[model samples]
Target: MEQPNSPEAAADRVLDAALMHVAFDGWTDATFRAAVLDSGVDAALAKALFPRGGLDLAIAYHRRGDTLMREALAKTDLSSMRFRDRVAHAVRLRIEAVEDREAVRRGTTLFALPLHAAEGARLIWGTADAIWDALGDASRDLNWYTKRATLSGVYSSTVLYWLGDDSLGHQATWDFLDRRIEDVMRFEKVKAQLRENPLSKAILSGPLKFMENIRKPVVPDDLPGRVMDRFRPKS
Candidate 1:
């Protein structure tokens, strides 16, 4: 039965329907349209609720999830946390958020890929690798947005792969994630090394000096001489 329509209620219905459609039919334009129709809402309202359609809704969901994760991250002193712990926390938060949403739709216990098992370990590692690449240099402004986008892309791809992976014990997907994490970790190490290198320091420092020079007004050669003359000790 269709829910009674308040603006908020109507929007919720659309989102609920859309998620169900994606779960069953996969995320596609046609599926989204079908979802809207199934939800028993006016098409105009659905279109307004999702301006770019299902893809937009999907992206919005990811963005909302990222926002939630970032809020949690902001409250923590990441410097105090070990790197692996931080990575694990971040990954787990994201996975749980997705699983919770899935539970709302499907009402089942979604299992975490076991971290100790070979396949499960691989999945965790691969996701971590992609996350590191997305994060880049740990600069709050640059790395945060980049990593969020990268994580979203990796997560979506991972979900798709998982759906299709029916191998014994679902080991194939886990193995794939493991390899992915290793590659990302290797790249992150290289990035960390480059940042720490003397040459990189010199290069970054050079730009700062150049900016300082540009900010100050260029003085005429006579200006220094005049200033010196004013300060000259009596002969």
Candidate 2:
């Protein structure tokens, strides 16, 4: 529903042009100029629309996908699904939001640059946070941080997997996504179990030395044998 010529609409036009060029130029300032030129908008408008040039254009591209996912999610009633299923739907919808394979490939190649790798991470973090928010997550503390962290791993892996998928309908990628979600579930279960165990309480409260071998049995195999032999009569 973009108006014919608003600032926001103009930015969209520039961004649309940028995507067309990214597959060819890999999100460079060259791509930015070309997009502005191709859009027939004033070149200065690129600075106003994306001050950081190509990097900002890349972020905006991601934001457009996030917006599409959010809009589609609004139409669904996720209340009936389990939280994991809801999470699955949310991620799948986000992936579906991206229709341009070349655009995604170029974005990945652009972000792989050492300077922009951090930027790429921030981009992934943004999408994770967006997906969680779109799913109506309401946690407001450490849980919020942990939730986003976990989903960040899930979303990143799925996106990478999706990039190489050649299956009809990308069914293989969806399977990979399901497995990653299951990994999260199993990890949470492990964390819960550890919290319920008294040994974990000791590990948290005990001396730092205790933590070094927390995964091992409480009694050292060699220590127990040596102690028992010492207790026997010295012969």
Candidate 3:
């Protein structure tokens, strides 16, 4: 049964409780129960709001970051910046919006478990997809997948780095992130150059030609819907 509050409101209420306990309890069943007690919602209501327990909260946590990132990105003036700068800022905004560093730290630990790793990857991919969409990327082919895959590495590594960073204002972690972005930029430049090279073109034109033989790639825009479907209860 649905709760009296709208889905969004109920989710927010549950999330409030979850954020309070996740940092210490690590998104376990114990944390779920604690969040339920803290939320003052009927036990069944809490279950309905978060059928997957802590994993749902973790997803909500990721989504909250995405929301925060989009809002923050909107306020920043990025029109004058380079493409890479915009992308980097988009990623940094997501991290900086975090109110509690340990929530992320605990989330990292939770996702690191073998059983949770796939779900973690899915969350990371969603974050990457959100960031790219925010950046106004128009590429619909190979670039779409490659861009998100690369950003996931950058975002994940930066989050892990930020977890341990003790510098004032996390200045050191930002410095590390800058270097990583530069690395990606350099790699992208190489790929662009390779794509333009005559030898590469010749290779693609050869008898066993490459580009034409490969099937077109498709990145479904409904990934989040598909992901949620996996957790939805069957009728």
Q: List per-candidate RMSD values in Å.
A: 16.8, 17.6, 5.3
Candidate 1: the clashing residue pairs are: 122-177, 122-178, 125-181, 126-177, 126-181, 134-147
Best by TM-score: 3
Model 1: per-residue lDDT, tens digit, 54-123?
5545544554455455556556666876664565456545544563344222211111324223433333
TM-score of each: 0.48, 0.83, 0.85
Give the per-residue lDDT digits (tens) of candidate 3, residues 1-235: 4456777677777788888887678877788888888877778878887898988888788788888898899889998999888988888899998998988888888899999899999999999988898888777665677888999999999999999999998998889989999999999999888779989867756643543444426556469657566567853
Q: Judge candidate 3 against the unseen true structure and give its global Cα lDDT, from 0 to 1.
A: 0.84
Instruction: Report the C-alpha displacement of residue 144, candidate 3, in angstroms.
Output: 0.6
* Per-model lDDT: 0.55, 0.84, 0.84
- Model 1, total clashes: 6
The list of candidate 3 runs beyond 4 A from truth reads 1-4, 205-235
Candidate 2 Cα errors over 4 Å, as ranges: 1-3, 205-235
Residue runs of model 1 more than 4 Å from their true location after superposition:
1-6, 23-30, 60-81, 92-138, 141-161, 167-179, 199-235
For model 3, state the Cα shift of residue 34 in Å: 1.3
**Lowest lDDT block of 10, candidate 2:** 212-221
Q: Locate the minimum summed-lDDT window of 10 residues in model 1.
A: 104-113
